[model samples]
Target: MLVYSFQGFSQERPLQQSKELPQRTDAPTNSQQPNNPNQDNNEKGRKTLEPRPISEYKIISVKNDTTHVDTALTIVKDYEFNYLRKDDLHLLPFTNVGQTYVTLSHTFNTTSLMPLFGARARHFNYYEVEDINYYHVPTPVTELYFRTVFEQGQNLEAFFTTNISPQVNIFIGYKGLRSLGKYQHILTSTGNFQVGFSVDTKNDRYHVKTHFTAQDLLNQENGGLSPQGVINYLGDDEEFDDRSALDVNFEDAENILDGRRFYLNQSYDIIKKNDSIQNNQITLGHVIDFTDKEYRYEQSSANEIFGEAFETTNLRDEVEFQEVNNQLSLTFSNAVLGRIGGLIGHADYNYGYQRVLIQESGTIPNRLIGDVFYTGATYNNTIGKLAIDGLAKINVSGDFDGNHIQGAISYPLSIGSISASVSTNSRRPNYNFLLYQSDYVEYNWFNDFDNVQTQRLAFDFKSKKYVDASLTFTTINNYTYFAANGIEVDQEGFENPVTFNIAKPTQYDEQVNYLKLKASKTFEYGVLGSSSDLIYQNVSSDDEVLNVPDIVVRSSLYYKDHWFDKALYLQTGFTAKYFTSYNGDGYDPILAEFYTQNQQEIEGFPIVDFFFNAKIKTARIYFKVENIPSLLFGNDNFVAPAQPFRDDVIRFGLQWNYFL
Candidate 1:
């Protein structure tokens, strides 16, 4: 582990000042003295001061971990220069910006006690409570990020924060993107806006924090490519080089997801004591959260690709979800007991369509509305050289029953730290699995499903001198997913028949056992360095329901040095990634979800990119040529079924910070 050092500041006068000079007896009184022209004095006769060290600017996480602003250029910073502003090692991006990503990995660790809203693809950029951060800085700070997109637009994020007083801080931020893809009818536009503030009392006994967010993600869906389009894409003909020239399944369909949220968290210390006097304290905390979201799909005319629909023109389907949650907690802390806390929470939710669907065989209700009460406990302690943490939660009264328990222990060694954890969770499936309604004839259904249970054990080791590695084994029972029901038919085209599958919700009856191991290491010699990341996964089940590639690997070779007499830091690298061929999942435009499919075996191919990054002062610049291999080979790589990967292109971006 790497520990950062922070510079400290003090307000005390210099000791040499008292011994060097003394005030004369005839000198004017303090108020009668003339002020310096360069000095800025407050109403209280104090000079305005600005922080000189970056450590004075703090960023606080939900768990209260504090880290300062960093302005260094490193390999980790280069990997996170994408639209998502995070490392994309375990994810596959779509051809267009602001689009969904294909998941290449899975982790079963969770603390949520309620079923999630469906349309997970749209939630990739959604900001939840845990995603938000609080800031405490001595002066105002601003950050700006900009990047180029595929064809016509750009992506940008702007953030600003300032401290009004020693106890109050506020911030506002917005991220927006607009991109017209190389293909027809695949444009994407998204926006996210957030504003928040944090305040504490003069005595530091009480604190309050609150935030509000509004977000919208919209995509013009063309249902991938038509059968002929796929043929033309793979043929690599010069005439069809322009993707817009190719045909598509439909051109008049689109989907939109919009949401708004308000959150508040406050804490008060009732009994406080200094650690030197008596290491004992008691605190009370409360949290309130509210969210409202809607997902809508619209088409000007119905298309036969999705089967029959009720209306031929002006077809639309929409669903809404709203939730409100409140929690109260009490905690006790001591030198011997560490920290222990208990909490009780209540959640009220409403999810469904606007009207019921009355069919010949059955009737589907309009909505599912209910209230749930839950209780949970948390503990953290350190004994000798080992640290232990545990949490347990269960629903006491609710329409659905769910429980979660997790525990972990970690110990530090001479070079690094090693940790082991175990967790078990039992919860209902997502809202869409239990109930859904759509205009398409094959898309409406309601069912009663059993709770899904999952148990996992994991071990991890972290060391910069050695290697970072982790292994996890998980078992899942009553797994639920979306799959397709295919129907083969002969068309008028001059070739073999084709198959079209309609997506539907389903649950697997047997248990699935899965194991994953990932390791990464870096070696540096002089100015030349090499880094590699590898992942191995295996699945055991009676049926071919769960599928993943057996091997995934990424390697990078780079050169780093300071140029212009150490004023500019530069790094140039080549990165290559590959995975074994497997049966990849298929995407559905109507449901905005990926379903299990075994018909098409997607072949694995290597993708290589060249990047040049540099840091000058408080700015970081990035330049990359993405998918350089595609320029020399055939266009056969696909992120999903019939969805070709992006072509070779040059992209550039930059991040800059300002302090005042």
Candidate 2:
């Protein structure tokens, strides 16, 4: 289904984890039977999947499409299972959903700070984004989601699919979460899984897709709190109410990340099906893609307080990475090639092999090998309702050498859609940033940096009824990060006396700019509904090496009805979020990275919530009370630079579906 290279390889890279979805995406399976796809004729025994059009279903983003829809429109959102809660729930707002970041990206990176285990956010390969389906269904399809809060936080998702015949179609999926944090030894757990199949080949020209994915992310590094244990663990007296009994500054720190991926995407159809635009319908294709991946990070226990990060002290911190990809494509389509509607194209070549394994504690025991090649193309167009997308990439040797490109445009209004894009990125450097051997001492290095550029521009608009807006700008040069000029004075000398911190990895030589603005709106009378979101940002070398938070706000108010007679359908809401102030970065679970902190700022805070959403007859329910005035504004919030999110709690959840 080069169906337009699925709209340009899902926007080509940068940003992973951080997620959301499930207003309803039927996919239930308890093992039903009969389906379609994978039948190029097989003597006419299978051939299904055509009778779809509920406005074409939709679930795009098997891994690309630069998904964006949630400037706070609220749904599910119980703080999306908290990865360090920066709010914006479904992720991408100060990242974390399995972690990986270069902050606002335009791809081309290798200033690796081990975004959790690097490879740029667990990419082993298994991406999907082709929605609206129904080819054949008279049974099997399942979905079940769950949520819980304060009971040690949790967020779970499920999936199942059917159709083992009529060609083929199969499925399985899951998303998991765990949070046992109330400060003091905070903890987090994550899991992701996927299973797949798709086909259609009995002459309808060929199409194939396969998937397998598994991910595990774990974290527990409370090296913060403990400047007297944050007033003895959020004290207001009451003996700090046993807040995990306070006391943190690495009590045996921890971090773990594991991943796996497998992929196969196939397509074939090289014109001549009675050409002549098939009487006005044109298409041409050829594609073969395969991928294999693995990423690992481990740290069981080791801590000395930032300065020495980890070199021993009993050792235990590992890193492993592997990647393999092979892609070859040539696709084309047209409903009118270049002026009004329908148009798709992609030209490509990507072959890669990269490996890295480094065990720690005095270095040496390393394994590194590299190979790469690249060429790229992607384009999509439709002029009537406006649509545009374009992307490019280049590399000839080693861990991302150079070149990247991006462009996007969207227009579809009557209710929503407005988009824009621009990008330019130059790379080089990321084989652990040109050699890393770790004996601690700031994790050894051998610098010679240069060539790291960026230029970005963006604009967005969305409205289904009210409003949604966005604007962004970025510029950078050299600008790598992970900084420090070292300081550890105490006893009236001030400086980082508290829980000590120091950093390394720097690269900045001027040129840094950023600007952002966003807005959201929702309102409904009658049954009552209200929503609002706003954000503003500006950074020009922010306090020496960028950190976010200029302003952010969210508000929601609701009331909906239908009970008993309607079998249930109730809703109630109140949500609030506020942001302002900054001083980002300060996380080092033994070099897991997020260093660079200036004194301390993290100011401006506000959080409030009260929800009760319901729907019976297929299940969907959520309840809330996060912060609820924190028993009346008790205060203790910090989404980074010492992590604190998760205090006043009481959350609930459930989601169910099964279409036979």
Q: Against the hidden reference, what TM-scores do the models get?
A: 0.92, 0.30
The lowest-lDDT stretch of 10 consecutive residues in candidate 1 is 1-10
Q: Write the per-residue lDDT of candidate 1 for residues 493-582, one digit (tens) a residue.
A: 737767777678889999999999999998989889888999999999998777788888999999998899967888899999998888
| Candidate 2 per-residue lDDT over residues 1-660, each given as its tens digit | 222332233222222311212223223332333344223436655443322212222222333233321212234344442433234421222212233332322223222111112333333121322321222222245667776633366767776665555456666777777766565554667777777776766666776666676767666656666566665545677667656667656555565656566666666666534454362332333333232333333444444454455445544545555545555656566655642222122212221123233445433334444555666667777878888877676664554466777778888877888888888877754544544544355565555687678778888888867688878788888877767545453523335464466567777888888787878777878788777777777777644677677776777788887779966777787888777667766655545556567777767567788888776655667777876766686657665655555556666777665443
Q: lDDT for every model?
A: 0.85, 0.55
lDDT of 2 at 424: 82
Task: Please name the candidate that would achieve the greatest TM-score relative to the true structure.
Answer: 1
| Candidate 1 vs. true structure, TM-score | 0.92
Best-performing candidate as measured by lDDT: 1
